[model samples]
Target: MNRILIVDDEAEIRESLEEILSEEGYAVSSTSSGTEAIVLLRDAPYDLLLLDIWLPDRDGLDVLADLASLETDDKPEVIIISGHATIETAVKATKLGAFDFLEKPLSLERTLIVVKNALEARRLRSENLEFKRQLTLETTITGESVPAKALRQQIKLMAPTNGRVLIYGESGTGKELIARAIHSESPRHDRVFIELNCAAIPEDFIESELFGYRNSAITGGPAEKRGTFERANGGTLFLDEVGDMSLKTQAKVLRALDEQSFVPVGAAHPISVDVRVIAATNKNLEEEIAKGNFREDLFYRLNVIPFFVPPLRDRKEDIPSLAREFLRIFGREYGRPRVEIAEDALDLLKQYPWPGNVRELKNILERVLILNPHVHRIERKHLPRLVYRTTGRRSDDFSTLQQAREAYERDYILRKIDECHGNISRAAESLGLERSHLYRKMKTLGISIRESVS
Candidate 1:
């Protein structure tokens, strides 16, 4: 059953919310004071909370601060209610971790809709957590290299503790794979592993998206929404690309890490959550700090369990194993009996500096499988142009110094044409060549002017 708790000093307000929520088929609880409300919340689990900002004994925000200090997983999704709270208070409550805030004259339709959405959000989270638990039993770390072995051992030791984890690696270096490995090995493996890509979310909405929003409607909708942090209760929250988060949002995050609770955007009551945070980033966070873009305190909090993913260049010995794994997967995908790697091709692969890392390797293998037709072995000739180097040059010779300069000019003109923004005239001006000359040079270079410009 969906459970809700209403905390307000006014008896009528509490009764109204309880009656409406209960009629909507929620198991509802109400309290007339923040003090008693906290006590009640501590005793039982609630899916959502309706918190009033003012109380006779203590301020609702103070109650939120206290709730944030608690060490438990049953913290409620809090919505703050206030008669005439300032914008500053609302923002502060949100920064502190309130789900959202509601003004005095609350609408019944708005309240019911928000309540339903919050309940549904919680339900989806529960389902996702169950899925993660199943994934944990099925997945395993694949490589047998020294770095992989050491990483697995470190995860085994660190998973049981509550320390935050910072995972650093380049793109496709499998930072998230390692994070999931740690979570699966941890005490909270059975709980949800919620992820937020800080770089993917727009800077304007990062805070509300992370902490959540209170009474405010979902963008382009009439109903309110719950954030990822609330959804990850009793689990691990993974912040991928965390270095991309804006400085403003980073400060709020630092506070949440310090206080262990926060209010969502446009909320009144503070929401408390108990979650182990794991953050991943491709960028150098130290450089980001030097640029004054990241919070120092938050850095310390997350760095308590730092793990670095070794780039493929640093562990070239693992290339053969990784290559075989990719080949097997691609062979099954293509379903062409079976495919094998030639000794020469494998040697070429080992020698290549893979700047794009594992992703690049996977793509190369897939391309080779597709283009090789019925060939059993992938050879070097089937590789992309970027992977190969020719031994000799000087096939086309210039007659004189002026002719060589003209040839260089022709190549430069063709390149400019290719780089232009789909405008022939613009390419002509950019190359300091007449449109007619540019067109003629393009023809001689065997390049279509329109194709090159585009």
Candidate 2:
């Protein structure tokens, strides 16, 4: 049940509110003194708080002032009520994060409605805070190498600035993760963080996707749509694989970046925005520009704050920590205790040249843990041939034919799953296996059927 606290000096008013709220299935508490209300708030959690402006011992606004000092999760939605409330008082309460305000003689109907809406909004805020907390924990940079330290420092320094950032890195080098880190650490952390992949969308639809369309803008345009820029106003817009953007679209994007305004597909009026653009590219944009595939003006516009994400192979010494971090995460997710990596297995990971970079390492570790759920320790005997190749050693790392066969089967199934975009049925069909049988095979092979599907 939603909990509500009422603070009013009038005994009758307090009794009336407490009765009504209790009848409405709320855990209602009322106190006539502002000092006593503060004591109650500090003792327990409340979904909503109702404070009257006039109090004998202390002013009601004092309670709102104390709210800012409390932890974010402990703060309640405050509704200021006053019989002679002025416009200035209402504005002040709003500036202090009041959910809503009501006049002296409260309408029971309006009070209930506001309470319901305020509780719902509070619930949403709590969920969002939890998600952001988890996101911050997961995306934490987890390496101790020099490159890692340097990169973290650069992000810290540049994240607060409004300069456009261009991230250069190889595929699977955690470019998107780094972009999100920059956004989360920036001043606009509370605003939207929009991402678009130039390589994912077709050239014909890319323009409309970035800068939305009006009714009948194209063959199948929606009546009205908010483009990425408008949605990400006062926030961040991350453009991934920007090297793949078409020359025509590049020119349009350049204009938007320069002017912070763009016209929709079927609209003549240009809409202005206040988004910070962050572009990422795996290919060498300078080389692409020389080849006439990428625009030079666009390159300069995006390169205001350039960042190069080092590949996994370049930071081999950081492998043990990164590997263990992944193991801990995957273990918790798979409902298993932390999986241990033998020194040999750790050495192989460090020596291997991760062509796909950190993303590949994460994927391989996830597969390993999901498959070896019952195994407490990962050894060379458990390492896949894909990892063995990185050791500059022969295939003799595995002592048994069964291990080799299992490794081969695991790799083949993973590739098929990728080819089918995580569709188990489609992968089974392509491999000439029954869907049910393939699921059994995956389970037996330690390839988590659940993790693969996503």
Candidate 3:
């Protein structure tokens, strides 16, 4: 049976919540003091907590701040109850990690509905998390080269520790893959492994996105949400492209890293989380620090477990193994019969300086498989023109010109849609295309635009 805890100073209120919840087949517990609530919560497991914002002996927000320090997975979902709450206090409660803010004149019907929804949501979330973990494929280093073997060894050595890690590598060098590998081997393997690309989000949204904001925290903001640190509690948080983060945000992250707690964007109360931090970057951070673009102090904190991912060019010996693996996967995915890459073609792949790293190799192999419909064994002659050249640009002289154009156009449309707020009409107008024509193009390209504002 699901468990519920009611923490209200008013004896009548606590009795009401407990009687209502118990009638609905829930295991119920009640407390009138914030101090006793904290003790009970620490001692036992409760699925949900009904917290009062104001108490006789202490403020209820302080109890929430205390609950936020929980180190166990059984931390209860908190719903704040208040009789005289301002919008500001409601938002502050939300930022302090309250699941929901409820008014004091609680309608029995509304209370039951909210309580049922919160419990069901938690059940669904837990189910989805377990389902995702079961479906995810395991990542292997897939190389026998010196660098690859050394990296595997280093990960084995560092996976058990709680030290913060800083990974250095070029784009597509499998930094994320290595991070996941470490997580999989670590003590926190069963927990979540959250990732955020620091470069992908804009400067203003970065703070709110990472630390989250309460409802209506900023001028015309969206609803309350949990941030990365909170979501990754008791797990690992991988910060990709950490060099791109602004120095101001870096300082805030540094403070949270040190204290394991932080105030949300517009809330006074602070929430604490226990998250293992793993940061990755492609830029020379030393140079960025010298130029005052990166934080020196944050760098030292994250660099406790320094790791350097070898670029594809430096680990050329791994190319053949990686290439074969990609070919096998793509061959099955593209519905092509079994195929093979000749020795000469494999040698040519090794000769090329893969500036895009392993990602380029995977994409190129997929293209080769799709383009070679009749050839079961890929030869050097079947490779694209850009593969052997210094530049990736294709002239009209290439045979795969049409295929390359369609691929580029598909990518361009996706980017335009993101920039246009997922609005097909806006994206079409910006791209100088008629609405109907753009609709047809999107259908032909297998693109689904959900925000179809007419």
Candidate 4:
């Protein structure tokens, strides 16, 4: 429930407001002195404060000034109430962060409307704060490799500018995260950050999605809808997989970038927007341009500042940190907070070439957490067979013959078990060994029967 505090010298007025507000389903508290109201605010949080200008202990405006100095997340929205009506006092109250001003003869309907609006405004402020916090957490770059450090430095240098950025990376290398980091550090950080995946949308509807339609522009669509360009006005617009955009859409997008204005479908007038464009693509745009698939002009417009994000294989040294970060993330998500990875398991992770990059590693960790709910510390045996089986290591990669022999045996045994669909007796029979001997070999190789089967 929304909490309201009333600070007025008049006992009759305070009691009446408290009763009315309480009946309206609000938790209301009344105090006859501004001093006591301040004390009450310090002790607890209130959504709205109804303060009277005429106070017995202190001036209500002075109390509002004091509120400015109070450092609290749950600061109340002030609604200044006064018997003496003056334009100057209302302006002063507004300048001092008062949400609204009310006269001596408060209308029940007006008071209720103002109170509701104040509470709603406070709720929106809280939500916006929470959203920014989450965005910061999600966009953090979690690696200590040379490439990772260079990318961070580049973002810091380029984010403050209005130049267009084009990110080049393999799929799942975190191009979108880099875009968001740039937007968060940019001058327009307070504004909206809109994203549209060019490849994900159908070619037939890409134009309409980029520049929204008006008055049933499509057959059965809404009457009027704003596009990403319009929604991202005075902010940043990220176009992911820009290489996949058709030549026809490319022409219109180029014009929009040049003119900073575009007419929505079925609309007569053009809407101008101040938006910084950031584009990302996995395919080589230069190759696409040469192949006559992508437009050269659009590529030039978005490639003002180019960023290359290396794939996970190139940054193998960061695998341990990345693995632990993923573990922490999925652990908290799955309510398994103290989960830890063994060093040997991390070594195996670093050996494998991540085909799906960071995204694949994250999925594997989450899967491990979900499948092994009782396990606190993740060991090599807890990992899936694919992780150790398909490492694709050459004999020279191993320092000793024993290491090479053990790796070969581990792969061969896993293949047999997999071929038998994880049947231990059948696998042992095919290998010309007893079930107990096979189990002993698996234990030596750090392979779990349950993991292989599951």
Candidate 5:
């Protein structure tokens, strides 16, 4: 439930407002003085604050001023409620971060509406803060290696330009991270960064989402809907897994690039935008074009500036740094104080082929942290068994080695299947094996379809 704080000197007013807000299903608190309200706010979390200008102790404006000095994340919205305040005071309150001001005679309906609006604004601010936080942690490129340094330099150079960039890498190689970094570092950083995973979005709704429809009488009355293109105006639009974009959408995208504009679905007028396109794909565009699954024209348009993100194998030197980063991140996430990886554990990680890349590494570390808890150091025994067997470092016994190898393969295949929701074709593609081969392997490994999934 949303928490609200009501501040008023009058006992009747505080009680009445508290009753009204509580009846409306809001968690409400009340204080008679600004000093007490400030103390309460400091101690607790509230979504919105209802403040009276004529307070016995400190002025409400002073409270608003103090709120302005605090960090954005912890600040709750203020709604000034004053019977004896002037328009000038109301304007000043608004200028000092008040969401809105209500007169002395507060109508329950109007008060509720303003409260709802304030809560919505606060929710949006919270969400944006979370988005930015995630962007900083997950999107920021992390490495001091030569390849990573080069990648950063490339982003700095190409980000300023309006040319579209094609990011190439394997799955979980942080291609989206590169895309976000380029946009965040660019001149259009203030504008929104809209992302669409071409592979994930269904083909049917691609057009509608990329170029929104005009809400018409036939379709649904003439209300204009902004698509991702419009939403990303004066900003960056990242098309993830661009190679997976259907041929039809690819052609439309090519046209949009050529014209620098597009009409919404059912709209007559074309809307122009100054959006920078950033395309990423795990697949090789040349091969995709050869297979005729991707458009050649679209490929050329998006590949104006190519950025190839090296796979984990190519950047093995960064494993220690990356592993330590994951250890720190996962440790905090799993409520562990501080966790570190032992030398042997780090060596085992370096030896494994991280086919799933950074994402996989983060996931595995999270699992380890959850299992181990607040432990200080992670050792080789804490490592997953597949890491050893898959790295071709098995024991002397042929039978034991074979069993280990089969176990590793079984675990790998199962993970892939689970990732793709047990879709055989998708899992096979991820494993770089034919569907028939995967089926045979599953059988040979004694992985029963029913028992395994259940």
Candidate 6:
């Protein structure tokens, strides 16, 4: 139900509003003092506030100032009520964030209509806030590895600044996530975040995508189209795979960054914008510049703040946590909640070198859940064969005999545990060792028991 708080010094007026709004199916609360209304608002959320100008305790305008000062997003839409209604007073109330004004001889029909509209506006505002919150969550960089922690700290320090950022990472290493994280934490967080993939767009269309066209710049395009830069004004524009941009396009981007304005195709006047550019690429930009493929001026302009996202293989210890997070995410999405991964399965994941990085791991987990919908618990055998079969390290990959032996033992024990369905006793018997001895060996090997099995 839509909630309304009525703040009127007149007892009869408050009672009348309460009764009428209650009949209209609104959850209504009334207070005679502006002070009490402020307290009520602080205590709970209300969709609308019917505020009276003549409160015995305090002036309604002062109350409006207090409401504006309150650091909260759930502020109510205020409708000002006054017996001595004046144009100046209405204008002042409006300036103080009042949604509308009501006169002494209130019109029942008009009041109801205004109240309904205010509530609808409140609902829309709430939805927008929720949508932005979801977007922020999606950009969260997960993991506790050193690189991950450092990246988050770097984002926190650099995000508040307007300086351009250039992210460096291998393909599928989450360069876009890093860009988004920076934008989400930046001063322009509340503004739009626009992303354009330089490599994805064809050379012919890339320029138009970055700086929109007017008057049907393309043979049969729209009359006028806003480009990523214009759409991201007062916000952030993320250019993914920026190294792939042609020198011609790079020159234009350099100019836009320098002047904070651009002339759209087929347009005479250049539009000015306050945009923060964040670019990311898998290729070494310095090498690109050396080869004359990338512009040095553009590189220097965007490289003010540089970020590197480490590949998954470099942070293999974070795989267990990342794997679990992906499983939980995909589990809820696939209608298979409480999905558990066997320790043996996790060991295989850790052993494999993820050339595709975190993105590949996420895809593999989602694929596993999709292919095995009926299985609540994922075992080693459930993983793709490539994870284990191709994960073995060559003898030369190991520096010492001890390292190679430990790797072999760990793999053998994991295999036996998987074959025995995680039965410690049977695995120990098969290995000709006591259960207690096997437990000690498993502990020495750093194998954790994450799932219970027969």
> Which has the greatest lDDT?
4
* Backbone collisions counted per model: 19, 2, 0, 0, 1, 0
Candidate 4, residue 382: Cα displacement in angstroms equals 1.3
Worst 10 residues of 2 by lDDT: 388-397
Off by over 4 Å in 6: 1-133, 217-219, 391-454
CA lDDT, every prediction? 0.76, 0.85, 0.83, 0.90, 0.82, 0.86
Per residue, candidate 5 scores C-alpha lDDT tens digits across 1-454 of: 9999999999998898999999999999888888888778887888999999989998889988877776546689999998978878978998998999888788989999999999999999999998888767865677767998899899889888888899999998889889988888888888899998888889987998899888545544446668899888889999988888888898889988899899899898999998899999889889988998888878888899999989886687778888888888777666675687888677657766788888888888877777666468987656654554454433432246666677577668877877887688898999999989988987776555543343
Give the per-residue Cα lDDT of candidate 2 at 252: 96
After superposition, candidate 4 runs with Cα above 4 Å error: 1-133, 217-220, 394-399
Lowest summed lDDT across 10 adjacent residues in model 6 is found at 445-454
lDDT digits (tens) for residues 106-129 of candidate 2: 899998898889899999998899
Q: lDDT score of model 4?
A: 0.90
Candidate 6 TM-score to native: 0.62
| lDDT per residue (tens digit) for residues 1-454 in model 4 | 9999999988889988999999999999898988988889988988899999989889899999988889887699999999995898888889999999888788989999999999999999888888877778788888989999999999999999999999999999999999999999999998999999999999888988999988864576589989999999999999999999999999999999999999998888999999999999999999999999998888999999999999997898888988888888888888889899999998778767788999888889889888889998999988988887645665555677877788888889999999999999999999999999999999998888887786
Model 4 weakest lDDT span, ten residues long: 389-398
lDDT of 6 by residue, 30-50 (tens): 999899888888889888999
Of 1 and 6, the candidate ahead on lDDT is: 6
Please write out the lDDT profile of model 1 over residues 303-332, one tens digit for every residue: 998998888666666677777777777787
- Candidate 6, residue 437: Cα displacement in angstroms equals 26
Candidates 4 and 6 compared by lDDT, better number = 4
What's the CA RMSD of model 1 in angstroms? 23.6
- Which sections of candidate 2 miss by over 4 Å? 1-132, 217-221, 390-454
Off by over 4 Å in 5: 1-135, 217-224, 391-454
Name the lDDT value of residue 188 in candidate 5.
88
| Span of ten consecutive residues with least summed lDDT in model 1 | 388-397
lDDT of 3 by residue, 1-454 (tens): 9889898988998898889989999999988899999999999888889999899888998999899987875477889999998889888878887778678788899899889888887787677776665434445677879999999999989999988999999999999988998898899989999999999999998888788877654566566878898899999999999999998899999999999998877777899999999999999999999999999999999999999988898888999999888887788777775789889677657756799999999899898787767779987667654454423433432347654565466557766766786787888899999989988886665444432221
